[model samples]
Target: MSALQVGLAVAGGLLLGGVIAWETWNARRRAPRQPVPERRPPAPEEGERVEPGVASALPTADDERLEPGFDTAPGALSPLGPVPAPEKRPRLDALIDVIAPIALDGRVVSGDAALAALPATRRVGSKPFAVEGRNVLTEEWEFPIAGQRYDALQAGVQLANRTGPLNEIEYSEYVMKAQHFADALGGAPEFPDMLHEVARARELDEFAATHDAQLSFTLRARLTAWSPGFVHQQAARLGFTAGAIPGRMVLPAEEPGLPPVLGLVFDPRAALSEDPEQSAINSLALSLDVPQVHRNARPFGRLRDVAFALAEVMDGEITDDTGQPLRTEMIDKIGQDLAQLYDTLDAHDLAAGSPQARRLFS
Candidate 1:
């Protein structure tokens, strides 16, 4: 029993104690995880609600409500169940019921009757230069043309009185009247009212006379009596500048007093040729064989169609200061197309006094 024996005995006792503690720790570590929650039995139909783990398996508040505009209740059938083949609306009947009228000027003119039967072109006075068809009555515009503040309706009436079956004479009278009005109003001051009307008239007359055709239609009347200032105002609204329009004037006759009158007509035609919207008007006129002062106006209508289509294409990309896109391309294309179309039209001799001619001439 020396010190070595005593140390070995103490070490054995310590090792045995450590083994017992290790066994206790291992037994605690091996205890089973807590048992998973068991599902409770579903409540009776008339009792408390049961929760579902998956949302799809449970009925929602909306599912229980009845579908609007349907006969079946919700939950009983699909909420959107074969959407009762949309009760078709009586479209034709509705159209007939709420049918609209063809409004001209301030009054309703036609409904179901053929437009041809209705006196579309009517002589206001006994004179041949009468308002035909659906000439819209406009508020009288006062302007200086020759040397007076003249109104187109008044001038038209005067021309009718002065000329009997003399369309040229009547037209001349219009020029004289406009000239007199212009002179009287101080020779092109702030606003020139007869710019479009007089200008268009002179051009049409000259062009028609050259082509051996007669100018006819509400358009003719509108031009003969259009207020240049009013036209400029309208142009401004459409994003064009309101001022003296730049143009190349082409006279109808080589008379002393005729140059200014012809210039009036020529300028508008050139200006209109540059406008995208008005370009189509020219084409439509050609297509319909509508008489125009300037033969050049014929191709403008088609150009306008192209311009409008181009504008539609650009949609939101190009816009003005107020979010309006400058239709520069459309306008340019219109001028180019009109030039080409004019060349083609010019090549083919416009039949003089044919059925196409007679309708306008006669």
Candidate 2:
């Protein structure tokens, strides 16, 4: 071996070693983190058969925080999880605080009297109104006005319209109603120009549009495979009640007054089919009407679990709204987007799923 040959061999060995080290570092950096495994209930013993329609036992309070994983076998519907408490309502911004106030005169007029003077109907066009005391912003009502006797008192009425500005007809109707109420009370009425509030309403509406998002996942069974009855049975076991429309199942909102957050439709139009057998369900859909539902609420996690479980049981694949296959990575990405959206709404004092927001968004 010559000196030059020995030197060249050493240099090549060092270069190869450095290249291998760089590749290893890059691979580790690019690798995804493993998700925490969801806790699941133990399987039934051999020869044991669970009947459909029997409700699963509820989890204890301490176990409420844990989420369940999706299972594929028959009778594996996961129990519903607890809903997290909503974030505190934030103070309303000046823009959102804008109101079209109607003030009436007469100490004789009580809240009931003023309310009676207005149209008997609760809503003017699509905008709902509330009668309040001199202060229209507060929830307090002027009914049973008690105080020192005065020549006249002011009764205020305002609209509950949100997420959109009032149109010309709505504005006209509101002003007319206020004037009519004043006349009935035998006192004059005053109102702010509709255009000013309309402008402000538009700004709030724009903010809502920017933050609003709808999340949906579709499940398609292997072609010509599952029956509609099977889909319905599985969905019922998962806690979805049948909706008004056939083939539609809804998970009722956790908070009674709120709207349902998630819906499952199995071939929505199957009932209209001439041949019942031909209408066998080929695909199922799961969707969340995001703005209508609160984030981190039980429905959010439960819906995801139900979709995954159904996909497993039916030998189906889950896809995005556009029909592209949905992967676990995609689910995480969607979740991150939702968290950011919730933060934005909270910052603006319009937390999604709050009472005020529900009225506005509705």
Candidate 3:
């Protein structure tokens, strides 16, 4: 071959190799990253302890080194003043329950007699069933207590839940349970028209399906992966504590009985691992169930703040399920939309975070 031709061939070979190398580099960069095993951290250092708290807001967002204040007496949270006893869940509401009134014919029924007449289980098919008695003196409807006297009785079954709308089978089951209980107490029971009530369930389910909203953001490690202990320690500084489930943390509501305001979750496997520090967790999740939390608690805002705060301290990036970066504009827009949702729920008599709304949404 001519000398000029040989030189051109050599130049072309080098250029082709360079192009392949560049493409490979870009591919690796774009691919999702895996977790890197982490080592155990040192003991606590000189710092302010993060006080354990959960409510409308944390004491302060910037504080680090938060710790749970334990009561020497009963292991209760002390800083919050003995962690008030969890409040009783609210009673059934007619708006969400298919109620059946039982006429006792002026017979004074003992609480024990009523309790004995209750169904073997409180559930009628997929819905929750409750029986309330009208106290003779107080004139209030409540569950039968062992020693109380009641003049009237009523039973109710939930209309809808996460499982779906009430159907023929469930409504029938409710009727049977109510009838059996009323017969034992010698009370005449009256239930709504089944078909009509079932229709109401469908409509309510439709509204719920359209309005139900839950938000989640995944935080992927930007450099080094996190260990379970590391994740817990960092979140504790922000007033989060170990939640009921493994690998989950919760920001508690100020109201003892209310559902948590927000959740922080990581890989369960890592949390359960024998050597948690050696188990790498590449991603974490933050979530909010809008209807479960009260609007005054500002759940969405708290979730946003916690997400960004954790990302900054942990050297991570907040992304969607697909790992795409979640932009600030999108997050802000969600907050605005949530505000509108809260208003709609309020208009429907199921305000966000209210007991009635919580039960219906459940």
lDDT of 3 at 180: 98
Model 2 lDDT, residue 76, Cα: 28
Expressed as tens digits, the lDDT of each residue in 1-362 for candidate 1 is 99999999999999999999999977554431222233555665986676666422112234322122221111122232221111121111110011111222233222122222223332323332211122224333221122222122212321111112224444444345333433432332121233443344444445444433221111121111222333333222222232355422121211222111111121355345544222212111111222222332222332233223222221212232243343657545645644554344345332321222222333
- Indicate the residue-level lDDT of 171 in model 2: 68
The order of the candidates by TM-score, greatest first, is 3, 2, 1
Q: Best lDDT goes to which candidate? A: 3
> Model 2, range 157-247, lDDT digits (tens) per residue?
2233443555667767766765665677677655666677666666666776677776778998653355556666667656577889977
- Report the lDDT of model 1 for residue 225: 26
lDDT tens digits by residue: candidate 3, 21-72: 9999976654433333444446556795756754332224234522122111
Tell how far residue 278 is off in model 1, in angstroms.
Answer: 63
Q: How many steric overlaps are in each model, in order?
A: 43, 0, 5
Better of 1 and 3 by lDDT: 3
Q: Which stretches of candidate 3 lie over 4 Å from their true place?
A: 1-87
- The number of residue pairs in model 1 that clash at the backbone is 43
